[model samples]
Target: MILHFLGSRGCIDQRSSRHWRHSAMMITQGRERILVDCGEDWLDELDSLRPDAVILTHAHPDHTGGLERGAPCPVWATPGCWQSLDALPVAERRLLHPGQPTAVAALQLTPCPLAHSVRAPAVGLLLDEGAHRIFYSPDVAELSDPATTLRDVSLYIGDGASFDASLLRVENGNLCGHAPIPSQLDWCAAACVKRALFTHCGEEIVSGSHEEMNKRLENLGKERGIEAALAFDGLEVKF
Candidate 1:
């Protein structure tokens, strides 16, 4: 499996050379290419990626705005996501159910519901490529099924909205905003996930000193018995 982070910036005013664009990713396996998330920053330029299909994590403008112009390939999204994307001119729309594995590009993708914006509702994905397994959620407040969803996963890519401080809020009985990096690391540790990468960077991540953040993340990872790192645009991971 091969993965590329097309964008890593979160919904914040901050933008740097390393964390400029909103979160988006491209996964390629065999001859198939799947693009995930198409934030507002990408709205004017969707033709460059040339994806065979597009998969959405949620309907937030930061994750779905780029599709306003329609896509060249099929688009897959959860029912909730479709509710927000219904007006978009995507060429094709397919349903992907939570807890149900959907086949795409010879890989199995299982959506795991998460605690996030009630209006936009989000889902973390479990990508299984037979030889490799990964769970990725660029924005999450809490995961519904951590144990089952993260079991034996090789890599865990998650929200980077905050590092040590809590940026979460409870609204109308649903958790919203991003969980701190420390909290997510604990989840990874409990699930026995050995490596983790964070994207969708918030102000702290985009403005903080990379050296200091790396040290802090390294220390946190050491305590959790896992390897933790931040992801930037154009970053690639292959396994």
Candidate 2:
């Protein structure tokens, strides 16, 4: 599987040449092309990417607003996510169930509930092709089932709203906001996942100096016994 980070900026006004667009990613396996999240920033250029399908994580504008003008391909999301995207005239709308792996094209995707928005529920995806497995969650507070979701995961991609400080909040006993980077890295260590990449960048990463930020993540990865790296727009990795 080949993963591409099309956008990385979080919900912030801050922007830079390297990480200006909202969070989105493209997955490619042979001739199959799958896009994850289509933020408003990607609307104008989405067609050019030519994905076979679009998988949404949540209903947030930064994650689904790109389809406001209708999608060029099939759109897949959980029931909660469809509630927010029903107004769009997408060609095909598929409902994804948490824990039930859905085969699309040539890959398998299993959604896992995430603690992000109560009003607009979110899910992280476990993508697999035979023995290769990867977990992707651009905006997450907590995983509903870490034992199964993180099991045998080769790579973990996650939120990067804050580097070290806590940004999580409780809303009517529900968790919202992104977990700190250090805490996420700790999750990677516990999961026994040897590699991790962070996207959905916030000011701490977009506005701060790149060299300093990379060094911080590098040192953290070294201590955690995992390979950690910050994802930037247009960044691509093959697994």
Candidate 3:
């Protein structure tokens, strides 16, 4: 399995030097490309990658930004996600019913819930075969899935929007609900994750030096004794 990230920016796409990251990801697992998310401006990239399945974790605009780019092959999302995505006029809106096994480009995937700040319950996908498993999660407060769904996962990706709890609560202050990076790590460790990744970062993250953030995450990983890395746009991972 190979993971190709076309864009990794979290929410909004503020095109500055620090935040060039888009918000698209493509996974080439079974000869076909399985696209995870596609922001609006990612049409150019999608035009190149004719994906077999476009999986949607949530109905947020940054995640569904480029839905019209494709003729709409197989778009997977939770039932709530479907309710939220009612505005989009797509060819197919396959509802991701929990615990149901579905095919995504030759690989079987299961949908699990990830409690998020949005009106709809967010999702965390487990794409696996008889042996290998890859947990793909974005835009959530923490890992809110049932334990059986995430046992001994090989790769884990999650939302890490802010640097700390203080910033999470204080970011623009009036902005109600959001989770931070440190809190996200807390959830990952409790989940007993293997080879974890922190993505869906806020704009402040891009502005601050990744080196500094990397240092902190490195220390956290050492303390927890687990594998973790910061996710970036255009990053390619071969499993």
Candidate 4:
């Protein structure tokens, strides 16, 4: 399977050439095209994208605002996500259960619950074809079951909200917000995942010097014995 990053910026006002658009990813295998998220930046570009289906991680505006006008094909999301999008004019809505693998053409997607937002709860996806496995979660605070979710994963695409400082907060006794890059790298190392790429970039990445940040990420990965880098718009990876 081939993965393409459509956007990399987080829900921040700051924008750079590398992280200009909101977070989104397009996965393709053979003739099947599946869009991961359709943020506001892609509201008017759906026709051009022409995806066979759209699978959402959550109902955050930065992730789902583009579907305000409705989608061209079937939309698959969790029950919580569908509830938040109930008022939208979606033509087809498919329910996705966490931990249950769903087949979309040649790929299998398993949604794993994540500790992110209380209002708009999110899930990280475990994408598996027969030969390759990838874990994608652009906005994440904590994973409920990292061992099970990350098992045999070859690549991990995680949040880039912060590089080292934790953005975690306790709201109504639940953890919310993004996890730092260092913490995510630890997860990758523990899971034995060799390659990792971070997206959903926050101010630290979008506003800071790219050269310094890249060096920091490289050094951090080396310490943990993993390969890591930052993801950018239009970046493509095959696995």
Clashing residue pairs in candidate 4 are none
Estimate TM-scores for all models: 0.97, 0.96, 0.85, 0.97
**Order of candidate numbers by TM-score, starting with the best:** 4, 1, 2, 3
lDDT of 2 at 202: 91
Candidate with the greatest TM-score versus the true structure: 4
Tens digits of per-residue lDDT, candidate 3, 1-239, equal 78886766777545434346555678887688888877676656665678888888777777776775454477878788878776676777677787788886676888876656456556778878556787777676555443455687767776656666443322232322356766655655666765677777676666677888767776776676667777877788886
Clashes of 4: 0
The model with the greater lDDT, 2 or 3, is 2
Q: Which one wins on lDDT?
A: 4
Off by over 4 Å in 4: none
Off by over 4 Å in 1: none
| Model 2, span 44-111: residue lDDT tens | 98889999999999999999888888888888999888887768778799889877889876778888
Candidate 4 C-alpha error for residue 63, in Å: 0.3
Question: By the TM-score metric, which is better: model 2 or model 4?
Answer: 4
For model 2, the stretches where C-alpha displacement exceeds 4 angstroms are none
Question: Clash number for every model?
Answer: 0, 0, 2, 0
- Expressed as tens digits, the lDDT of each residue in 69-103 for candidate 1 is 89988889999989987789886898999889899
- State model 4's lDDT: 0.91
Give the Å error, residue 48, model 2. 1.0
